[model samples]
Target: MKVIKKMSMTMALIAASATAAFASGQQAEEISYYEPGASIESIVVDAAGKGQVGNWGLGNEYEVQALLTKYGQPTTYLSQAFDMDGFDDDSILLASAMTYNELGLVKNSYDGGYSYGEGVSYIDMNDEGVAMLEDNLFTTAAFAAENPETVKAFIYASMKGWAYACENPEEAAEIVFNYGSSVSPEHQAYMAEQVKKLVETDTMGNMVRDYGKMDEAAMAQTLELAKTYIKLEDSVAASALEAMSLEDVMDASYWEMAMGSSGAFSPEKSEVSIQLKWLPQSQFMGYYVALDKGFYEEVGLSVNIIPGGGDIGETTAVYTGQVDFGVTWVSNLIAANAGGMGLLEVAQVYQRSGLVLVYKTN
Candidate 1:
């Protein structure tokens, strides 16, 4: 892994001073917006005609706003809920679900009918969710069995990219910050440190090399626990179990071919456009690479990377074919499949979950 050293003390101090100055009412000049006769829908259609995957390239911003509206509050509620001093488990779960939705990994009715007043709650991944998750995994594996080479290649590439991000925090942070408009400098630095800690301390290192590899034993154990602990509806069938296998669904070789030997996956070159949802940090690097380095052009892809503000529903986008692909957590994928979204796990970007339950010091 290539190490990018942190900012020097002098530079840090200068940045801090600058930030303080900005915070004290020395506001940055805002860009003027002249409304064009063209609507966002028209721009998106034109971009799509030219090979852009995401509609208007707006990405998760719309989803975030929608979620906030649904919650009857501002999106800042996430940061507030994360503060341990005012922690609310119920809020966290709803926030997590909302984030998952924005990432296009789950579906929810935003009719203002769902209760948001519940204090604290937990999605007991105890038995039922676990079983469902495992069932989906096996279904995926079974799909991959017919195309082992493809599955292996995709998994390998995904694992490689994920591992690289995990191993190099500063570099990754730089990539993300360059593209993520929502991430402030302080948050970027904090996220980088957090990712580093998670990767170094968790089981991500062990799973990195085994990118496409799935453990049958682990899958079985997970399934058993799911069945034993949770309530599964009668709708779940035995046939679904047979279809759920690690070997059934992954198609890494397809991605390998798509990416080519240069390791740049471009959707611009292809006549078909692919929608892409970028994980927070990964989204940054991906956008920078696509826009700055022209990786999208190189791969014959016109990519539109949507920013996730922890409130977009990526799974819904995929299900609706609004976007071709999205960056999301594994659990969302499980839920998506269960909900009958023909979504597949093309790659595992983060080896370990980045979701953390933070508490306030006060």
Candidate 2:
């Protein structure tokens, strides 16, 4: 049986090859490694013939697909995402794991976990330069244009909530747990810790003090990836997707206004609703923190956070005016506007991509 180790920075650098063909603003792929006596070439060779990989559908799956395709390997999707049984049985060669969620289960011995410990290896999208931005705050362009004060107030309060969550992850986890976390208590705590890393770290592994500030370089890389991978059925939408500039999808002015203003604010809209990308968990602790910590109230806003995961997507909900703002990946926001939804991202939440591909070692 083969043993897998968790992706370690300590992995020995044996062989390395890089390409300049990736999106602009993306760092060159510096290194790829496996366990002792293993090379990236060997792993790709094995993966090519095996053709077994696992990922949830949509952007994350696309990220994995892009990476594997770059390696010249066949991408055979798994029936289920995050299937630990398949990972342990070698039925799946690579399984998608988000640092904040599925990775906790993969590493912890708690319920619904494999407890793989140091026996798993992973390929990081950030390192590979295929990373797409995740978890942004966005609304329709009309909403933002019509209600600048409301947008600024929301951003100010939300960034404060994220700051609190990052500083006190354990408490943030508990707070989210109280809000009906879908995962177990232990996993929730693990998620908070991991999410803190994502919020406070940049793709280049630099520590970021400011919360919710969009990194233009990272956004550019994300846009390039979205344009490369995302294909639209609507010909008009496809043309829009191809023609999308950074300005079409995001408005940094709102974030700038929020950051420049004093903590005091009077919102034009006193009450508003925002949608989450998924069910309650530490993945979205910042918003919960804002509500629980009275940051939203401080801004004179009553916020209703609608949980996501139904037929209606977050982008659609915001575009259709079901919510004033929504938390979604940057790619989703771009695709939404390209489809003529006119969504505009107000702030970026997760600074680094949390997606990784986990596999066992020989």
Query: Global lDDT of each model?
Result: 0.36, 0.82
Encode model 2's per-residue lDDT on 1-362: one tens digit a residue. 33333232123121112333432212222222246456654665565455666777765566776787777776557754435666665556667789877777887899877887777777788888778889999999999988899999999999999999999999999999998877788888899999999999999999998899999999999998888778789999999999999999888999998999997887889899999999889999999999999999999999998887644499988888878999999988888788898999999999999998777653
Score candidate 2 by lDDT: 0.82
Cα miss at 343, model 2 (Å)?
A: 0.5
Q: For model 1, how does the per-residue alpha-carbon lDDT over 164-212 read when each residue is reduced to its tens digit?
A: 5556656666666776545454445445555443333322224234333
In model 1, what is the error at residue 152, expressed in angstroms? 11
RMSD of 2: 9.8
- TM-score (all chains, Cα) for each model: 0.46, 0.87
**Distance from true location, Cα of 223 in model 1, Å:** 6.4
- lDDT, candidate 1, equals 0.36
Clashes of 2: 7
Q: Best-fitting candidate, measured by TM-score?
A: 2
Model 1 residue 339 CA deviation (Å) reads 2.5
